[model samples]
Target: MKLLLASSLALATVLGGGASAQTPPTRDPAQIQAGTYAVDPGHTQVGWRVSHMGFSNYAGGFSDVSGTLDLQPKTPATSKLSIKIPVASVTTTSDKLTGELKGDQWLDAGKFPEMTFVSTKVTPEGKDKAKVAGNLTLHGVTKPVTLDVTLVGAGVNPLNKKVTVGFEATGTLKRSEFGVKTYVPLIGDDLHLTIAGAFERQD
Candidate 1:
């Protein structure tokens, strides 16, 4: 339908960002300083992949996603995330396709304009990995989804001198679950999602 579980791994990445900031001494979530972090509006995105018949795969993504991360330093496993993804931001490299996505048979952005994901639990897998589970709401239906998350990096941005955290998350979802079953088994019932973004320290 549309993308952005952009809130997707926020559950995944929310597991963990300042200036005059020194380089990140350690990549460990616990080692890194903890505080509330803001998801970078411009640097974050939700990538979607679906099958285009048996011949090929069609891929696209959503942009302009925004979110917040509340990280618990000592217990990184308790971190929480909230993210918002607007249906209007979907892009598929084709104006016609993009239009179809926003129409009634697909996303129906006019009525339900936003898709959201809010983390309910974050379980640490190891030093840099975690399993984040959350409720995903799309097209007016809500479902539980889990993501596999890995911390990509954590450091101070040299240009801004602020602490930042980066993460990569992957998950699978069924577009039909949300009521956007425009194309059934032919197009694809499952959609693989990739969410990558950086969160900036607020405190």
Candidate 2:
């Protein structure tokens, strides 16, 4: 098998050489070119957690999340983020529990089929961080909320070879404030939300 061995060795050497020559470009979130980007729904997540009578924390997530982001890297205050979450896409551990959560006693998904957030302002906390203030409409009520946002990074996606940016945001809202007072104090009036979002350049 001398000929086969030589061919394999030569192929390995060529691949190794190519690998050594390619270096991932430096990632600088601040340098992300200004553009309109669509949030990659498949790579994005919307999760929420609530305390259950101080005994346990229940958590769930939503899918079919869609959004668009217009970024102004140079003037972050001008950037905007808008997202719509289908209440019917709620996911939990049990199918039965999911049904209960979507009923009139809770989210009332039948009445309000969707929840949305539109950023009204972006206040820079520091480099790569910001306080995003937005109006959240849910369960037939609207309230102002502020998300503590951190830029995870921005770079070219190796798989698709497209410019991509990611972020993690956390915020808290009072369920009662949104007219969702099913169990109130027992179910915990506050709901914590964590969003992991990815956006790709559109133009």
lDDT (10s digit) by residue, model 2, range 116-173 = 9999999987778999999999998988999999988887776687888899999999
Candidate 2 at 202: error in angstroms?
A: 0.5
* Sliding window of 10 residues with minimal summed lDDT for model 2: 21-30
Candidate 1 clashes between residue pairs 3 or more apart in a chain or in different chains: 5-8, 9-12, 17-201, 18-162, 18-163, 19-161, 19-162
* CA deviation > 4 Å runs, candidate 1: 1-26
Assess each prediction's global lDDT (C-alpha) against the native. 0.85, 0.90
Error of 2 at 145 (Å): 0.5
Give residue 142's lDDT in candidate 1 (0 to 100): 94
